[model samples]
Target: MDVRAAACRVEAPASRPLDGTVVRASGDSVAVRVAASRLRALGCAIRTGGAPLPPDAPAGLLRVERAPWISGGHALPECRIGWSGPVAVPMAGERDVQAACGIMHVHGRATGGPRALRVDYASVCAGVLAAQAVTAGMLALLRGGTAVRAATSVAQAAALALTQYVAVATTDPGSGSSRPEPGAERTPPFRSAGGVRFEIETFRAESWLRFWTGLGAERSAIAAGWPPFQQRFATATCTLPPGLQAVAAAWDYPAVRRAAQAAGVGIVAVSDAGTPLPPPPASPWRLRPLPTAQATEEAPAPDGRPRTGDGPLAGIRVVESANRVQGPLSGHVLGLLGADVVRLEPPGGDPMRGVPPMAGEVSARFLALNRGKGAVEADLKSRAGRETALRLAASSDVFLQNWAPGRAARFALDAADLVAVQPRLVYAYAGGWAEVLPAPQPMGTDYLVQAHTGVAALLSPPGRPPAPTLMTITDVLGALISAEGVVAGLLGAGRTGAGVRVETALADAGRLLRDTHEVGDRTADATAPVVSDLAAMAADPAYAALFETDGAAVYSRAPWTFTRPSDHRREEP
Candidate 1:
């Protein structure tokens, strides 16, 4: 189907602002054009080839087109991109809004395994970059009160989408036995207690033992009945024989909650959230650019490049007090630009640093997202730590966190609280679900978001159980969205010299996944299934061209490249 036709089939909410340009094309072009459509909406002027900016075009113009290259062990169609001002483009858009989004489960040698879902990660990455560019452009406009020219290519956006899955590392200790057996399928681990079924994820053997003990049940009975591979789900059934019945008979959600809370275990009642979800912007993810304050000041980078700092975000200071992959990834990407990012961790450091697949004290996941950022050790719970963080916030352009609902307020890190101190700071939050949902305060994770938002259901095959996307898909998207909001908010602040609050919820991202894929009778137009799995995706000449090798390892090429460095002048509006 043609890209324009596919876009027409997209069902957007009536209230969604018609803010961006929408381009239509087909076939290989769909991938890039879909992302380009999003960038245009974020306040960018698209250009093709190595073309010079039009005389009338505004400053910070992005010249986007295409090229081809080979490096390392892989090849890819080069999505060459350049920015006029300090950075490329602002990053902002709903994950589900991009047309022709192709999601698939690929099983090939490139996947490193049969079950790995390694679809077009490069495209995902490119989409993320586009969001960043547009966000930056939006910020510049908010600051200078002028529109900036933003550009990107179809191939680059496609490559970015695919980057999320590449070289991903998980802490799950390869405990495959807990996965249900084919013929012995059972209800989800949600067991009925007091006539209510709740999802109790004890994926790990240790967590299973903890739940069992917390319920005052016999470990011996559990050990005797279930094998290593089945222990996680053995308790998932509705009925347990006499020997193993405490969890159901004696324990209710409240009782389990108390014990689990005390023991730091995981449990939640099954939510009834189904499709036809609330309209777009379903998540708390928000972008509010404050009015540029009078006498607003932007500190210069140590290696000064531009008065607005350097690179797109040059001197912007970001304090990232987030844990795990989702929130950190946002800050990491900002650092990749020109932002001065300072990651605040507890004195003991983020627990993720100690997760498996570690190299010394930090894990690959930590290093991957936290790269190019400074670190600070401060416990938010302590008064001294709070004060120190407040100081940091006061000096930063953005403050990002992923604490549970209201936790930030309790800790005096909430937007309202921080805005009092840093009136120009872009306060951002990324979480699992939206606060509007019934279970607003429930502990949310990538898996829980998948399970709760029906993503698992959609991914599930005909008769099998619901399955989650291969990686922390929602988390990554949420992080990227949140980051984009921060930049856009900052841009607005630069203009009005006022701060704004930005939010992105995993639930909202999940909703995007559902909406984009749940088009009734319009699936064919929204996406055309690609048979290429991980190996095929890896070997595809187009996909291969996207990768660049540094002799040691092959990875997705960075989106921004300097063609010829020179001072960029702004055009009069």
Candidate 2:
């Protein structure tokens, strides 16, 4: 699909003034056009034909455009770039970016062939990052900072998508051994005797055991499959015992589903391209302003030190209690925008913090999303722990969480609970299925949500069985949307002097990706050699500067670059 056509389909809310900023888009790249669309959706007036503003115009004027490449204080002309595919065009297309950044490598590892996502994944990501940069710039201006120029490339965005994988590849000695051998029995999208292909999910080992046992699988096979299945999220590869597949294939889908339900496991049949699913939310998130009468005034900095930074959220404080990729990544993005984020962990800290591939004292995957954040250990189930969280929220600008459904409310750490104590807070909930699916929702993990929403089908190559991309597509995109929503909520709160509630879901993220355009045969070259080695890719001078190395760990730099006029000046990326 043409990048611009696909970008035009991205849904954004009606325009509303975000401090009456005059945003403009002048480049023809997909990233530039989509950022303009998003800014317009956020209600910034787009300046198409206006008198050129004075070079020193106030901070409200913002521009978002694309560049061929941005690295080491230099941006090559769009026409001079020549690594991805065809050089005849001004910029590389999405497929070239995907192949170059190792996205296809990770995405196709389990699917038997490397292919770009049917959706314009990289361009859309870059566009969203661009929009986020603009929003952060606006926030910086509102917070009494100078105007800023931000730039991002599709390659940078693609590299950001591979951050977790890169972290593991660079830090873990045993990472390479986790890859599935050719023709090995893979996991999930299991086919039943009736020929129904589906995905199943359960975080608890006991539940997994029960689900498999209910399907009459041998005890040893069930045990053998559990570890790989559970670790798939972190490792992006699942090699299961053949007996498990045999057991699943012995029964019809109804029987398989019945066993799943009896075992408290979540199950969803892989959807087809023509399946009738609920439409995605008009916008990726729902933001509602709470009554101002109950709102608390913004808290003053405890140390009384003035915040100073080029990033938009210089002094904002965020309290995040989230487990996996979606929620933690949201906080990470906020941190990238200059927020001071403090993680709320359990008494022993998050268990994932110890999951393999250690970078210093923390898991490389965990650090990928949590690198500059502070941590506080608290048990939210206890009254004292709840009070600790409440106190943190009382002094914070945003409280972000992605606990399982009702888990927050059960512990009285829900949005309502937090907003009551901190009425000026932006309460952001990154959830799964968020009233979109019917009662009895499937597990809200990335793969299952993809299956339930037909994203697995949409991303699968032609003639291949529906398979979820192993790259955690929805989790990452959902994080982007979550951060964007939080920023929007913060802006609304700034305008209305009230707390704002922002809710987003994995289901919505999947829906957005799937429904963005009609599925077609557009895919990257499946026959091309898969470039799965991110560490090697990072070492190449073409992308080396986009990553930073600490000890043995490698981390992708922030995708967007922000600079003030005094620091440097550039009209394009």
Q: Which candidate is the best by lDDT?
A: 2
TM-score of each candidate structure, all chains considered together: 0.63, 0.85
User: In candidate 1, what are the lDDT values of residues 1-573, reduced to their tens digit?
Assistant: 222122223322211211332222111222244345445544434543334434322212333221111012111111223211112222122121122122333212112222322123323444446556645643433233233334454334443444433322122223222233333323333444675445554435665566667677787855643443233211112222345544445676688777766655565654433644556552234555433422233422123223354455666788999986678878876775568888889997787675444434555445556756788999788899999898888777789898877788788777877877777677888877664356534567765676667766665445754544434567766676677667666654543345667777877667655544532222232222232333334344544544543332233443453221223332211
Q: Model 2, range 306-371, lDDT digits (tens) per residue?
A: 555446688888999998899999999899888889999999999989988889888999989899
Whole-model alpha-carbon lDDT for candidate 1: 0.49
After the best TM-score superposition of candidate 1, give how far the Cα of residue 99 lies from its true spot, in angstroms.
20
TM-score (C-alpha) between model 2 and the true structure: 0.85
Error of 2 at 31 (Å): 3.3
Instruction: Please report the candidate that would top TM-score against the real structure.
Output: 2
**What 10-residue stretch in candidate 1 is worst by lDDT?**
67-76
